[model samples]
Target: MHYVDLDKIELKDIPKISDPDGRGNLSVVERDFLPFTIKRVYYLYDVPSSSTRGGHAHKELQQFLIALSGSFDVVLDNGKSRRTITLNKPDKGLLIPNGVWRELEDFSSGAVCLSLVSEEYNEDDYIREYEEFMLFKSS
Candidate 1:
């Protein structure tokens, strides 16, 4: 892994259009919405609040994470500095670049985490161990 600046992680408020029925808001993410073209999309739901997810770093994956339903907190580490970001609005998302370690925790009930990735699933691209991640960053 290479050194990633913590300042590069950003929370973006996607444009939301209200429903004609005055019911709810809708946000769209086309290719123009992100720096990279999205190739994979996934979501996490029905998670216990005490459970934590995402304790790894990717070699070449960029992702945009959204709170589609409730809320959660994302803790980011770049092997030098750390930061915590809260995602509660459906129209907002966090843009995470490659080489940064991310952990998701403190999920509210009925919370849904939607992730849009720049690449397809590749297990070899992920560094699942913290020590290995640290070594990669130092190299």
Candidate 2:
């Protein structure tokens, strides 16, 4: 395992195009907004307010999380440091690099989380335990 700096985490504002008729806004995410090509896209919705999600770290996958409807808090940890970020706007996202541990919590009612990933789903690439994540980070 190698040491990954906590500074690599970042919040980016995605561009939104508004309709002229005052109907709604459109947000776009392209290759320019991310560090790598997006290979998968998914969303989490209808989560209960008391529930939490994402208690794991990826070995090589990079992800960008966006709040499409309501709001939620994302807690990121790199073994040595930790940071919490709130996402509330559809036009904004949080970038989580590889090897970082993430937890989603404090989801407001009707909150929707959209994720853009650099790779497809692979169970072997995920580190699901905190103790194992710490060991992986230190090695």
Candidate 3:
């Protein structure tokens, strides 16, 4: 259960280009620029500004989270301690290792968060309850 900080992350910038269509202009993230050997890629959109997400902890997957738009606070807890990180830059991401409990809080309006995972979705890999997380960690 460890919090991989910015100093430890090997960041690879996701490419973006302008596209002005009949509607409006937009930027897209290129596939190659997303260098991770991803097994699962998911995005969290329309997250309520007053609510928080992600209360569970993973057992074997490593995830890199990026705030693609707007900003949010990532609260990380490694069995012993916790820290809150504000992610606002697209080029930056938080690399979270297995066993840590994470919570995404203080989401700004219209925030889009991208999560790149090392493994595909598996129900057994997740520890969804805080009490269970503490017990499992202790054992």
Candidate 4:
């Protein structure tokens, strides 16, 4: 764990372009709005309602998670405290900095979660165990 303040993790509103003819709203993410450079992009969809995603903290990677379709909840834990954030809007997202633990759950049907990460897929950068994460925070 890198020991970041849990309060720093919160939702951010992305700029939306609304069409007058009801085509749909468009939200864009540029490099200036984020604290890190995006190195990977992925998404989760067609997940069973009972399943959850993410159960670890990162050593250095940062991520932005958006509910692009339906809705889901992200539970964040930072060794000493925990919080839950519901992402239901397409134009808003949760920015999770490094060191904070996250778990995504309560996904609605047809839900889509788009993730923009600061780093590539690296297993060594992840802290998967809660006990180990806590220990890392103390050190």
Candidate 5:
């Protein structure tokens, strides 16, 4: 089987149930829709100019990123192909699997990026260097 690539990043659109009163609508993300089980939820707010985040690759964890407030670009690399995705809607999210290095850059004013992580934080599970990530992906 071909290895997963960053360009293969999947986009999922969360559906909102219609309510007659239009109050308290509910949305859900099915486990089958995601590659992994979500175990954590976090968000990034107040990014400074020329600043970037998530310049690393996970070994086993998967993440779904949603732009809850404004807009931002997510750059992903999988040793061969690279893709940049723009996130601007809260109902839409990108599913990034392990072995893909991702970087969040070019944040619009008042951007809030939410992340749903499959695994808990573990420093040993992250490959921070590009070269190291490439090597790990090849092997």
Candidate 6:
């Protein structure tokens, strides 16, 4: 597998519009803000505190994840390196590129994980096993 720089994976800001006179805040994710055109949108919510999600990697799929309600931890691995990122801000998002392993854990109560996907659902694109991911990286 070609080496991927873990440092390049960082949170991106979603454009925000502030409301005057103490009302509320609004954030927008425009078409030009993201590198990939979104083809699917989904969200995870009402999760148990001890439960975890996403223990797989994608071959050609890329995703942008956001914590729209509470917070969670995303553990990312790229064969030779690993890192953990905390998603706690609604206006910030994390982009997971293809060929990287990811796991979501440590979800706070009422946490919501919203995903903007680059492709439609396809079972063949996922690498569900860690061993298989390692092998795919080497090839």
Best by TM-score: 6
Q: How high is each candidate's TM-score? A: 0.95, 0.93, 0.77, 0.95, 0.87, 0.98
Each model's C-alpha lDDT? 0.93, 0.92, 0.79, 0.92, 0.86, 0.95
Candidate 4, residues 14-130, lDDT tens digits: the string is 999999999988899998988999999999999888999999989889999999999999999988889999999999999998888899999999999999999999999999998
What pairs collide in candidate 4? none
State the lDDT of candidate 2 residue by residue for 27-118, as single tens digits.
Answer: 99977779999999999999988898999999999999999999999988989889899999899899888999999999999999999999
Error of 6 at 129 (Å): 0.3
Better candidate number, 4 or 5, judged by lDDT: 4
Higher-ranked by lDDT: 1 or 3: 1
Q: Over the stretch 47-139, how does candidate 6's per-residue lDDT look in tens digits?
A: 887998999999999999999999999999999989999999999999999999999999999999999999999999999999999999999
Q: Judged by lDDT relative to the true structure, which candidate is superior, 2 or 5? A: 2
* Candidates' RMSD to native: 1.3, 1.3, 4.0, 1.2, 2.3, 0.7
Regions of candidate 5 where Cα sits further than 4 Å from its true position? 18-26, 30-33
> Which one wins by TM-score: 3 or 6?
6
TM-score of 1: 0.95
What is the lDDT for 45 in model 1? 99
Clashing pairs in 2: 1-139
**Highest-lDDT candidate:** 6
Error of 5 at 45 (Å): 0.4
Lowest summed-lDDT stretch of 10 residues in model 2? 1-10
Score candidate 4 by lDDT: 0.92
- Model 5: number of clashes? 0
| Runs in model 6 lying further than 4 Å from the true structure | none
Off by over 4 Å in 2: none
